[model samples]
Target: MKLSQSQSFVRFWAASTTSYFGTYITSLSLQVLIVANLQGGAADVGWMNASRWLPYVVLGLVAGVMIDRAQRKYVLVLTDLGRGILMALIGLTDLFGTLQMGWLMVMMMGFGILSIFHDAAYQSFVPQLVPKDMLTRANARLEQSAAVAESSGPALAGGLVAWVGAPFTVLVNAAAYGMSGAWMASIQHASKVEAPAGSVRTQVKEGLRWVYRHPYLRSLALNTHAWFFFHSMTGAVLVTFALVELGFNESKVGFALAAAGIGAVAGSFLSTMVGQRLGVGLAMTFSRILYVPALFLIAVAPSVDSFHSPVFPMFVVMSGQFLYGFAMGVEGPLEMGYRQTVTPLSLQGRMNATMRSINRSMIVIGAPLGGLIADTFGFRTSLTLAVAGLAFCAIWFWLSPMRHAKLDENQIEGV
Candidate 1:
């Protein structure tokens, strides 16, 4: 539990958390800023958002394999530096009155590439730093910190946008990424990734083959990917629904989101205690059930009322977000621990990337579809579909061995 034991990881984690905080700020601020400033439509918004993650969909698996071969610390540092420079240049353009939609989109795409290496390398590095028994707790701590950062990031960005301006938020983000890069460069442990013994394609295939062939991994990926796809679809439309349809102010959504973050923080702490008591598989399955009810609760919320009768949708969104965030917190550490425990240290980067690639692909597919549905059937109907997708995903786990799951102690032993 004590970070002092891993001085390098502590430094790295602290800086990374701050970097995460900045990333969200840029994300929320840019969407609101561009939409407000550009006189743009839904497509513009969609493209702006897509540009940030599209690179990952294209580069994830390849990046993972590359990270497995490269020095992880260098990858992390280089990516952070790239983002920092990009942000600084962005800030300069705003000052020069040369900022445009095209410029912003290109910036997004470039930074997206940098983030690929950053994320792929970091996930791979964690297992190398911690003991097998500590992986869950380590991931939990990191996830908890991230949840806390995300909870505050949007509001901070929104507030800055409201007060001083939107463009300046990029400056803040640039500074954070710079600091993060410096911290990453200070890591003492060299990565333990093994050089591939064969052709690049063959080695990459080996990584993918191992992950998909494992029964637990296959079941876990299906359910997890489904959960994320639907969640992203709903998330893509939530702000539009809450603010546009329900007439709640922007600040109100921020408050509800912040409250849910508090719940996420609780869940991160609870995960270790719960998982240890219930056994990992049983605990993961139980957490999966929580999500179904939560999604249902969210889909059915009524708009805020005249009687101020608790503003059903507002409270519902808040409660559902809390549960969803909590479940995600619980699920993440469980999955990461299980995956890392079973995967060889050398292939960690590739395995992590392969899983991340599938997850990102789901989002890439879901976002535009959600945008279309919201544009056509309406946000409420789109939300209903999203909830249905999530409910249907539950079946993925049920028919498989995952439902009555058991994470045997034997799985942790290395060959």
Candidate 2:
């Protein structure tokens, strides 16, 4: 069935888009809160990033097993509700004047813990909603809506933050999550996965082997982990660089960052066509290659001091963000489709959790390290290192066995 015809998919899409919109708001607002309100710096941003993903490193594998054993739809609804309440509490805490850097990080840590279950269940739930043959198209539709949210969410966030302060902006995010949970709960379909007869350790090992032992999955996982580490470093410092070095206010930064969402929207429209024309693996490789020049543009962008008009610098930076967003949009759907199509229903949760756990774990380590480097050296230097590391990822995928793997090969070797 076409994704458009599936009522469950429509509800799922609504839930995802709503959550993504709110999440993007929090993404920018928290940074503004830390930098402008709390007077924190790059290292603080890194620690904040690290704290949010720390749970994935600590409990990701175990979360995978639990998700596989639980009902994914219920997991999705509960996690969304949990996140909504958490965001509301955060907003209230800040309103009361007790939301400090340390406390904020602690709240983010709690948020991350809930996210591990949400994300893992979310990915695994898709195959159950749609047929295998339509995976690419389904993911493309999802990415398109997400891209739209990405495009406008931050711009709105910037406005909201500037107009009402960053603390209150979080309440908007809380409402979005609450709505997302309601949308998710309205889906009519129900799903449950029976637990395998094994200990948790044994189940985790099985997932690890499935990911690391498969020829295509192994190469893809390694390269993706590398890409995430470097990509997250850039993420850790980009807000600071824009605000501090480029002299951009929250509104200007939001407008510039919104360009990425625009690019992603364009890319989502092109994803299935690109995957078909270039082949899934090569299309993914092309996206990775695009990251190099994109980051390079940002790394070499002139500071506001160097340019008489900030427009020139902002334009340059925005161009880089657009290219980066476009690349991600092109790759995201194809990669998710490829993984889900090949993995069995029973193993979907494990496969997603295993890969995502390690991927986010890279965020835990790389975000702080990047922040520290930016603090110790300079933003440009840290960004340059990220560029170099991403270049390695591009090459790794380009030369690895992954480039030759086709999406049509939907069967896992041992499955």
Candidate 3:
């Protein structure tokens, strides 16, 4: 299939890319900032991190309903502007030496709200910009842009924080958000789509009811909920495991993670091909199956015979990450395309949000559970348990309704 492009899509994508890079920078800088200045241990850091994500667990569905009722570009612009202002405030507060834990919590809460809006709007807007046949390619390109930003952006932020102060590094992120807002300001589409014309209460219920009533959505919701639940457990403990248990240096951890970008790029490029060649159902099935092997690598990693075996363990870690990322990349576009095909455009925001909320709730539950498990057992054991959960997710799908479902261009009933 031929690729399609638009100036609007270009403008929006550029904005998105800049904003994504900014988010990575902000995230890295925040961790550095807190660790360098805040007292207490990894638990404290985990609490702060968990708090930031907690809202997604709680408010994702509501955000989606509200956002879907409004113009997505406007929602996007507002979110960018709000975050830019908030980051600027953080920089200013820190510069004045008036930063407090309470203020930081407030800032994080505001940040989380904006994030909810931004993600919901972005997901709902993209399908409108391209044709149905090109959904996989479009999502792939977006994933590639995000991977590039994420893979290298943290190192850049880490360096900036190391040389300058962490607070000043936030300015870079603020500028990126400002640039995103400025570029997005000129978008001409005006988000022609509107909610079903009715009272606000009825419209909201319709969006939720549409998703819950659909068999495909029901299966997807359950599958993704379980998948993210386990994945978040791994995320909760990974950095600490790498740094504390393995005694790896920051640079090593960064380098190991950066190497996975190559896998992400390959997987992103291959996602559409896999879907076309294997059929969307089989492609998704394969991706889900790959996780069992990919995640188990860490559990089964052999201790190196030589201290000179730094490269070998690093290779093991990176290879595992690569496989995990690749599977995710391959699955994303196909899942997105299938979801878009099944739902009406008007329902996109709420449906995405509901699914996302379910997923995030699992993450919320899993991350703390992971931390507690690691605290009680060991990091390696926690990781092994997470792998067990991944295997469970595949089993959930294999025996459930998703195994038999095919991607249909319109709604089909009862499989």
Candidate 4:
């Protein structure tokens, strides 16, 4: 069946795309609000980002178990509504002059909690919406929409922050989430996965065991954990460095980051061809290698003193972001498709949750660690660490079973 002909897919696509736009906007604007408006610093940014992922560390396993047993469609709708309400509350607080950093942190925690469930359900839900043979294509199309949103949302957010302030811009994100919830609610399909007859611990254990025991998945998980850990460190310090050290205004920073979106869009368009030509494992490995140079580029980005043109430093930073984003875009669809294909439908939610929890756990650690390093040693030092870590992860993947693995051969029997 043509993806265009599927009404359910269209509705799901719309909801996901809308949410992605709002998410990117919030990701950029919220940090700006903290640093620019609230007089927060690197530590504050780190803590806030840590708050956003803490829920995954705490509730991810439980959420995964619940998602596997429940109706995923309702899970998606409820989580979207929950996020909308939470973000709206943030906007209201800002409007009423009570938007403290403490309150913002709390709200981010709420968002994280909802995100744990929403992400687990959403990743697991996609396979039910499309045929098995079309999984890669469906994931590519979905990623394409997200890439387009990423390309534009940051630029728009930068403009909004310049014009209306960061707090007011959050209301737009709130409204987008609300609209996305409504779109999700409009889906007519019932996604009822049978609940496994086991205690939560038993279910969780089974999921973890499956992931660790499978050579391909174990390699993927290890590589993902390392990549996220280092990447989170880079992200934690990036905005602060741009704003404080480099003297970049909100709009300039947004536009610089937006360059990644352009590369991501190209990557999404080219993902299938890359996967076909290089094989999924090789494609993913190549992408990981790109992260070394891309991050090093950002780490060594020249300050204003090093360049005559004021825009030269900004150009250097954006070039790094573009390369990094392109690598991620090319890898995203292939990895996700391979993961879903290898796992059984019944365990999909748990698998995604387990992997994500492990990934996010690193964020919980990396965020604060990055902040501490930046505060103690400085941004350049912390970024240098990130560059080294990325190189190590690439080497790790190359040496693991993943280097020679292919998507077609990764599937286990009876999955």
The lDDT per prediction is 0.76, 0.91, 0.74, 0.89
lDDT of 3: 0.74
Rank ordering of all candidates by TM-score, starting from the highest: 2, 4, 1, 3
Residues 1-415, candidate 1: write the lDDT tens digits.
Answer: 5656898779878877989888867766666555566655444555666677778788888888788889889888888989989988877687677888899889988988898888888888888888877888888888888788767876777677677666788788898898888888888886555776777788779878877887777788778888878877776666556656665555666655655566678788888887888877777876777777776766676777643654666787789878877877777777788788888888888888888877867877787677678878777787889878877776666676555444467654422
Give the number of the best model, judged by lDDT: 2
Clashes found in each candidate (C-alpha, N, C closer than 3 A): 0, 0, 0, 0
Question: Which parts of model 2 are misplaced by more than 4 Å?
Answer: 410-415
Model 2, total clashes: 0
Task: List the candidate 3 regions with Cα displacement exceeding 4 Å.
Answer: 1-4, 90-102, 165-168, 199-201, 299-309, 410-415
RMSD of each: 2.5, 1.3, 2.9, 1.4
TM-score of each candidate structure, all chains considered together: 0.91, 0.98, 0.89, 0.97
Question: Candidate 2's C-alpha lDDT?
Answer: 0.91
**Least accurate stretch of 10 residues (summed lDDT) in model 1?**
406-415
**Superposed Cα deviation of residue 129, candidate 3 (Å):** 1.8
Q: In candidate 4, residue 225 scores what lDDT?
A: 95
